[model samples]
Target: MAKAVQKIKLSPSRDIPLNKLVLSQKNVRRIKAGISIEDLAEDIAHREKLLQSLYVLPILDPEGQETGMFEVPAGGRRYRALELLVKQKRLAKTAPVPCIIGDMGTEITAEEDSLAENVHRVALHPLDQFRAFQTLREQGRSEEDIAAIFFVSVNVVKQRLRLAAVSPKLLDVYAEDGMSLEQLMTFSVTGDHARQEQVWENVNKSGYDEPYQIRRVLTESTVNASDKRVRLVGLAAYEAAGGNVLHDLFEEDGGGWLQDVALLERLVAEKLRTEAEEIAAEGWKWIEVGASFPYGHDHGLRRLEGVLVDLTSEEQASLDALQAEYDALQAKFEDADELPDDVDVRFGELEEALAVFENRPDIFKPAEVSGAGVFVSIDSEGRLSVDRGYVRPEDEAPAAAFDVERGTDTSSTEGQEAGASVQRAAISVGGASTEPEEDDEDPARPLPDRLIIELTAHRTLALRNALGENPAIAFQAVLHNLVLTAFYRFTSSGSCLEIGLRTPTFPAQAPGLRESVSAKAVEARHESWKARLPKSENDLWDALTALDGGAQASLFAHCASFAVNAVYEPANRYNQGRVSAHGVRTRLDQANVLARAAGLDMVQAGWRPTVDNYLGRVTKPRILEAVREAKGESSAQLIDHLKKADMAKEAERLLDGSGWLPEPLRLADSSPSSAEPEGEAGPLPEFLAGEEDSANGSDEHPQQLDAAE
Candidate 1:
């Protein structure tokens, strides 16, 4: 057979002119168009400084010929940087850059190799590396191979790959200006050119060139856009129009104009009412018609259609203005406070008048407080009292309460008969005194005790009036009071009535008592329950029952506590079903347990043998002898006998026969006993003690055994 032909390995290298380094538009990756000239200038400056020390440039060949020159495999930036330097007169035009060249067959492999060689070896920016990696990927390279070549995690490679999908404009911007990888990454994820431009404009306007500020604005703006894109766009446009959009939208006006929806509603209703009255006086009914009536029915009355013409021009104008104003106000007040009492009452009066005119009793009632401040009352007895803090006249009847006389039994016939006779007499003699003496001596007529409490009857009215005058002050005061009341009732010892006082001094003293009491109550209940349980139990059953209950409760509480801790604590590594150890030693122990259970020999598995394990107790000589036996040596016994000798002596003897002993070992003396014994039937050589002896000759014969047996 003919001998195999040896292939020649070429150590490839190349040099190319800067002018030939054209960006391959066909192979060029598409990216965002956001790059600016200023950024490009900065990138050129940085790249120039980086490529200044380069020695040679890698060359490429489309064909296998060594003289052929093609596109550069890598160093595109370096070449561009040099060109920029030459243009800027920083370097001579004739200066050569170092590069490695390869042919078409090697182009793909060379590009990959170049990426791997430069990815970590050089200090290029992450984004630059990502771009290079992305270029290779577009050329049909796999992520695994890229990761392996770059010695990076697959996830890292994948993350870098995302840069390829980034807008070409943005990548160009990064290449030219050297923007932060973080900002670029954020912009990549958002993929909103308009928003990105807005962010850029904002940063530039703010004179903030820091990447962090840019990143912060991008992140916050993107998040804001998620829910408020339309509003944000409108606001942006409004701002651009010099309308002070932010202030107009967020700042509160003092007049109730911006505070109450009912005010606007009432204004509209008033105008409508005036028109209605005029129409009524003209012996015609008022009606709402046309496209404005979306329900496809006359809002007022079909018979009132002709009455619409009765409205004077000025009146009609006012009505139209009111309607327009109502629409605008309604839109503004979509989230504004509801109708106030005065507005509600006025609306009710208007609706009632309209209802009377229309012959319909079911006019809309403006919203009202169903339950106002506490209502108190007293009977014929002159007693002073209050309910929910409201004091009422003594003679006024309690609308929500009633009284029953004591000592009136219906179980006995005479009592029942007397009760029936009294009722019949009272009904027959209405307004007539039954018994003057009994009425005078009745103890049920005693005066009731006085009550003190907060009053909420006119709260809404006051708030409305305050809002009308100065909404800012009114809103502030209301919010302050609400906060104070919350603090008082939720954190106070007194009831809501006592906590309603607005005085600063008194409120300050009582503030938080309710909270204190609630906390104490909880603690007290827990302590009391704990105290009620047995201190100790002798019986396992009782103990177990108590433990079961306590443990179950503890487990629930612990789980809840753990959840809370996971949210608030920084060191909570536990997640889902995975258990974590806090210390390295514990983790090692866990690893060891897993290794042992998997039928793996810990020592053989590369685990350091510990004194606590059997492997650690085995002598080196016996191990060596066993190793020799496992190698299928015919003279296993001789190897074991040799191992029994002093390790240093045996090593010295073997090295001496091979004439390779070190000076120290060669200088050492070896007695006959230390050496192999001659014709020994009593005991073999010490080195052979652990090995099996064959039936061949001993050291006395000094004969070699066959290799197989």
Candidate 2:
């Protein structure tokens, strides 16, 4: 059976004193019992300040039994304010307070009404709003409905719902003090209460010094994983233990945060072991060839050893043949003097001599006789005919008529003395025939067929110096001009010039010569020289017009010549102003304007501004004042002396005391006079300028003084 609903009449007034009005103890306990009275008072004051025109009313029962009264829905704060006013004795005890009342219902319906009424009229804190949303969702409300109720996007509702799952402890902090929703969402992804609690503790402990510190600590500690709970708990433990577990196991003594040192050491040791194994498998060897010529030259000993080990039979046979040939040559040379005197000896005679020499090599060998020896054929008469031999001192001198041919002495001293007399006769005859030999040698002296035109040492040094001074210019003048000209003549003339008489091509073929010269010329013209031109019109003009008209024309001509030689020729004459006569004229015009503005001493005076002087009008005093003001300073001036006065004391006094002027402005709070008066106005004192008498007593008000006092 359904109980009949009570009909309660609501008052039209919006402001009601909750103290004066009767309310059910049950409703009072549900609404205001747990709330701090001081907080209620503050809220009431705030609401009253926000809405100056406000009122309240009462509620009644349907039995006409006056169970309760309902105030207009906007009067909650007003009722609280009225209660405060009554408590403070601002309103008389008998004075009526306005209110409207309504019937009671279930807690949910009451909460719905409260939320609906207050949602549009007041701004709730975001966390409170999110919690409200969660409560609605728990009551079987869809995301869309929750969003509509709160007048927010569905995504915003969903986001708030997600945040609701954040650790209750962290949520409590969020409620008491504001925190970023993004940070809460990030923590939620971990889904670990302990981890979230740790994060919250760290953040709170940091006193919100830097927002990124929390995220940085978390990201460095954790990895992304689907089982966020286990991962988060592990991460929390890791961070809480100061990230030193691995260090404890691997390090002898406690090392701070360097737990991976053992891992790094293990890796390096493994790499070294691998390298050692490879070296062993590859059979590396070191050879020390001590103290030899061509020092430190290895001569590829290892390669040589390999080749010796791998030699084939054919190579061995070839080596044997080479040894045999060497032996045969040695045998023939053993007694070369005993061999044939005929210059045109056959292969057969050479072989026979070689074989005989090989058989009895000692017989053909010539005795090492000193001085001179004679090979002579003697007849029955005491006359001797000589073969090839040295002259001896004991031998009689040859007759003056005997034509003796001198021959090289191959024997020792005894043989040389035997041939000395013949040699002296030969020398004397040669001297007598010197005139004929000169005439015969004269034909051999026709100007050398190949002239070796070598430069003198000094001339070569000078040429090298010139090249070093400017290789580009020297190369162009010497190689490009002379060598190219000679090459052109040779190629076009169709003449078969001798190789020695041909011009040298070495200089022309030198690397980087032509390209370097071109690059240097282009760079000098564009960068080094052209960069000297004035960047501004005034500077350009000043440079040009420094001379008289005749002098200017001469200067212009010089400039034009330089420009034509530098800018025009290299650039193909396409951009003439770069170094042209007209460019000189433009520079002259600029100079004239500059000279007129800055007087004839234009070089010293510099250029004048065409625009008005905006810089001069900005007040120096105002700028100084602005700086002083930024530094929290004040100043006064002695007008007659035109000097600053010491106002530090006066400024301090103004800051400390309140009189005709209020305290200096502050950033965080408004003027003190703007706050609501907590009590009734106190009685005025006689010392006050406008006040004549005290309405209460001396305790009610303190004395105010005139400026003269």
Candidate 3:
């Protein structure tokens, strides 16, 4: 302020006739890029005026005198647009165009002025543009209006508005370039600024701060719409109960997350209870209700066999018509590349119609229903699974011995009650009621346990000696034991030899595991053998003896197949004292041996990496890794910018037929994999080599992530 500053003269702006303006050759832009001049002309014609002023300089004569015409050095595009308008007669030839005439006396050259004008300009920040959209929205402009004005889709407008509506603090951080756009995009899932900032603070320095991880943390408390509970209670029902759902506009969220988990749980329980009551009305002694039951829930319970009920004539006709219509549609569009919307809808309707007949319940006898109970639960696909006719061990009737004299067994309900009087009159010597009637004092006393054991021990030694001599009988005995463990685990061993086989049923399995190709083949093979075999277990020896060597071997193989326990369970790996890690590893090693023997190939087994099964459940980096491995780095790059869900889906499509298998599903190499500890993750890919150190850095704490987990 001590010294006065001198002011410099600035360039003057004035209106120049369209005809008076000439294109400058000194303009730096030559190649056609971005918007075309034709489009710009149309835009100018639509607006009826130019929004930006052109930079012009007077043309010099040979003697350096001013010419009436001016040349645009920086705004040549505008001059061409105006020229186009004038030629089209949309604007008069003599129309005045706004221009900022550069000082002719200045030392700067036209080219230098043009370059400065172009280089000194700054484009608006994306955050500013987003807020501008927000402002337009706040000012009562419909999203459609904003989209129309900005030449963008309404969805784009909505995405911008959503991004702008994120916490002001986060937006400020975004403005400061504190986070990437993707991280900011995921943080927009929630409106709670405090939670957003806390999450950012928790994961900012940690490599764990991926977009999907942030989204996972934000929605941790909320239940996924694809959850079994949500499927049991429809989305509309959950929303109608005053629940809020946070949806993502960015990716496929499978309908989004339900904010009210407690509400959803309560609704699921209520619906299950209602379903149970309905089933109980069908004469069940008791009913168990839940979203799902553990596999083998009826391990010790007896499953009563019931015949498939015949459909009514009306129902059968409807089913036939539906099938015929479906077939007709399929034949009609057999050569079509894609189906029409109506055809697609009708196909779904026809499928539903067909499913109704297929799912028709079998009717159990009244007596069986009175003694058995129902397990009303939801299947993996969220369909109601009413497992009727399971009789608990305690509910079973007391066993009655055969009355040799009457040639009847009194175990049946009617037999027990009706034959009571007749049997008592004759002083029955069998069954529970025949226990030592004081009148006769003639009853078969129970044999001493030790005496029986000694007698059976002798018989067992003799039988073992005989079985050792005869390979055929030994094979049949082994098959019998396997058959019991496979199909009738509830049946106690009756053979003297204790051949052990344990088939651990998986508590959780992939959806439709029972409907897989391999599963169906196994089922068909088992049923074919069962149809040829005798009904009673007591006749098993005769049935085995009746079979030829080939048939006996096939039966043995079929039964032995059920004993394969190749399933990997985390609970089994860390069984405290029951099962050590080495034990689990050794079990899997044996499974590998079996796999090699069977020439098992997972790809041929129809196990592919699908979104629902594998890809969609893993992290984005993992999906990229799979894509990189199967397709190549270039292919991975194509989907690198996509959100986690979209990336997983795209990766699945890319990995199709690539024969890629996750480590767990892959056959172990010839190397001793059993020697490696289960805790080792092995070597990561080159692209993700440093990710581990960053993800689990010693200085960084991922408390929020662990807490959410």
Candidate 4:
């Protein structure tokens, strides 16, 4: 042997009287954390014993004589618990508590022993604890019972049980540090073992291992219950039709997701069809049924004038009584901070009764009904949105009578000539004319397209300047547009701007968009305007004119925001000879300039690159490009080794506060130093000032897809 080995001395344990034990000054704990002493004491008393032994030292006198007393060093919580039990008379003062008696020698101080005892012990691994909970469950212990036994919450117990319910292979992967606890939790969202393994296989390859990505790829086919279609077809009815719903216990799922999208769509279609059939009975020539209609579905169509169907005498009497009761209730509670429950319920009942009277169908003339159709679609709130009395161009009545001498004009050439005569007459003043009318702008030919464009362009600029200078007028103009679009079903375009506020039907928007910063800002601004608006239509004029300049400007900006649609529709589709591809590009370029002048920063507007939003949805190269742009190459290199899914996640985190935006959101030609190519410069070069022109094709944005074709 190299040297003689030293032997270690050990401490002995013994039962000490509860009264004989005194609190140790050397014990290091000072802050109260974790379980409270009172609860610990109750737990100890309920079990009739402590789970851990207390560390103690015998009290010695100055003369080296022994005293029948002890001081605790480690396990202070257990000591306090025993003391509390004794004070509560649950334990006799003379009751004995088992403890380890340290060697009385001064070689090792009480403080060192106490610190070592508390610090050296290892806590149980979470996976092990989860498995143990599973074992307890298998042994017939209820979740509540297990929670009581372990001093934890029932939800905590259930969460642990859910983790245990995951496949054993995944648990092994978790135990071996092959996956994170959060990633393991993602597997718990669905119970199919095969799907879990499949997701794991995909996650294990290269870099696609984020928890959210796992959930997305696993449930890509499922439809969220919050989807307007699902909300339209009630969840109860969907489930009654044998549809399955999967819930996320860990996150705010907003009522969870429906697994069968096909079933949901079928149910939605069936409901919509039923509603359409009921509306068809209202004598419309035809009914167009859909979950959503294109933004400009009624474009170029003539809207029929109709009267609101009068309420029956009984309905009118009910409505009057409800209004009276509602007025009385409002007066009674006018000064209250909150309404009483019964009164609130009564008000809701009154509102329902009133709505029955308010939503009466239109009474269109039989002649108009024969030529007009209805657009039946769901609104944003999942309510039935019936757009009535739109007469398509093909359905418009003939302008002039055709003398169809039934057998005399039977030749194909004569039939064609008749159609040509009808077409030519359709353009004239409702009569046969060999010569153009005297009031024609040009009898020789129609105005040149380029000249018309230039004229309209000048008019557009003038209107813009006028609208910008007079905020009050601008507000009224936009309000008029909104009211006409909402109530009249169709409107003649009188304003040069051609304002139309289309309700967005984003079929593939990122989750939680309604709660986004931009969305919230819009909602707040709308509510503020709504509050300031006059209650009576007759007071609207005074109310709007009374507003100060600053208030008027703010309201104007809010209203004008709805008219900003930079979205690109293909000329091949919705242009209908009005807008061209070149026109779309020109409009977008001008819109970008306006946005820059307004200092509109998408980031400031509350758009951020998130996995659910931008990252997870794009291609790997796009994700990497975004990362490389937002962060430098060095930062991008850090995540370059990851797979597509993993890279998107890491990229999202790295770019969180970096103020990064996708190509669709970025302001083209943002910097003054940027150069423009020859011939592609802005037509109004004076407006360029310091801004640069974008390359010929660089001005197009990705969000240019048509809302409707």
Error of 2 at 291 (Å): 54
Residue range 528-634, candidate 2, lDDT tens digits: 43455565567877766664675444333222211110010111244454333444333334323322322222111111110011001112242223223322222
Query: Best-fitting candidate, measured by TM-score?
Result: 3
Can you tell me which runs of candidate 3 are displaced by over 4 Å? Answer: 1-6, 31-51, 59-67, 79-95, 104-107, 329-348, 398-546, 553-709
Candidate 4 lDDT, tens digit per residue, 139-204? 999999999888899988988999898988999999999999988988887788888988899767
Worst 10 residues of 3 by lDDT: 700-709
Sort by TM-score, best first.
3, 4, 1, 2
TM-score of each candidate structure, all chains considered together: 0.20, 0.19, 0.62, 0.58
Error of 4 at 300 (Å): 5.0
* Each prediction's RMSD to truth: 37.8, 43.1, 15.6, 15.1
Q: Per-prediction count of colliding residue pairs?
A: 44, 54, 0, 1
Clash count for candidate 4 is 1
Q: What would the TM-score be for candidate 2 when compared with the true structure?
A: 0.19
For candidate 4, list the clashing residue pairs, or say none. Answer: 207-643
Better of 1 and 3 by lDDT: 3
Shift of residue 10 alpha carbon in model 1, Å: 14
Tens digit per residue, CA lDDT, model 3, 141-196: 99998886666789889889999988888888889988889889997777778998
Q: Give the per-residue lDDT digits (tens) of candidate 1, residues 1-709.
A: 9999999875465444555444332222233333333344355554544432222323345653444334544444455556667778766666544544444454546446445545546567666787799988989889997886555678778767865566666677777765666556555434457776676655554443344345444443111211221122233332343432111111121110111222322332343333333322221111221101111011111110111125568766765665565556556657747876765575555554443334321211111111111111111121211112111233133431232133332234423332332222211101111222223223244211100000010111111222223323323333443565677554322111111222111101111111232223334444554554555445544754766654545423322211100000112355323222233223223223322322322112122211111111234443333333222233234434332222222222232222221111111232111222333323332324333522222221111101010
